[model samples]
Target: MARAFIGLGSNLAQPAAQIQAALHAMTQLADTQLIAQSSLYGSKPMGPQDQPDYVNAVVALQTSLTPHQLLDALQRIELEHGRVRKAERWGPRTLDLDILLFDDLQFSDERLTIPHYGMRQREFVIYPLLEIAPQLVLPDGTPLSDLQHTCDVNGLIRLSAQ
Candidate 1:
């Protein structure tokens, strides 16, 4: 199995509820095991600050799925939750699942990028990530804790956990 980290977030229509629902759906994926999850963190929206605050968390999982397969699954979950990628980048959404890291794999394709291009630049992603895996490193060995310090997010706070 391949170990992976997924960043979860929601900012519309009961944000916390959507995150919990997505987690449940993830658990149901065949050949995928939800390993450890970080405590929830609330933070101001990263882009277009005019939107609602977001509830974010990180989940570590063991999955037999390939990178593309995992991406497909995440997109399905978003669709189930009524996610609409209309306008306003970083605008509010029902559910947003990002593949933060998939083992040490690295790739940049037209559709996706592993070790997510922005994982090292978001406090909302790094804070909860540090909670569950502080020593977690990218292929380049950058520590999660160190990355949290440089993100420019506002008002990041722990909310709850599973």
Candidate 2:
């Protein structure tokens, strides 16, 4: 099985409940096991400030599914929770599931990117990620803890334990 990390976020329709429900849905994916999850963290919206703040967390999974398969399952969960795609980037949503890392794999395609495209730059992503995998290193071998210090985490706050 491949060990992977997924970032979860929601800023609409009871954000905490949405993230909790998504965690449950993740455990039900075919051939996937939810190994661990970080506590929830609240952060300001990355895009337009007009929207609500986001609740974010990271989950670790062990799955027999390939990267694309996992991505498809995540998107399905988002849809089940009433997510809708919009032209505005990082807009508020009912659910947002991103593939942060998939077994040290460095890959990019039109559909997905492992070690997610902007993971390193976002404190909302980095802090929760650190909670679950403190020793994690990027595909290029940079330690996650080090990266955590470099991220701008001014508005990030721990909300509750998962």
Report every candidate's CA lDDT: 0.90, 0.94
Candidate 1 per-residue C-alpha lDDT over 54-106 given as tens digits, one digit per residue, 9 for 90 to 100: 99999999999999999999999999999998867788899999999999998
Clashing pairs in 2: none
Best by lDDT: 2
- The prediction achieving the highest TM-score against the true structure is 2
Q: Which ten residues in a row have the lowest lDDT in candidate 1?
A: 145-154
Alpha-carbon runs more than 4 Å astray in model 2: none
lDDT of 2 by residue, 92-160 (tens): 999999999999899998999887999999998899989989998899999999997789896999999
TM-score of each predicted structure versus truth: 0.95, 0.98
**lDDT value, residue 99 of candidate 2:** 94
**Which residue pairs does candidate 1 place in steric collision?**
none
Error of 1 at 75 (Å): 0.3
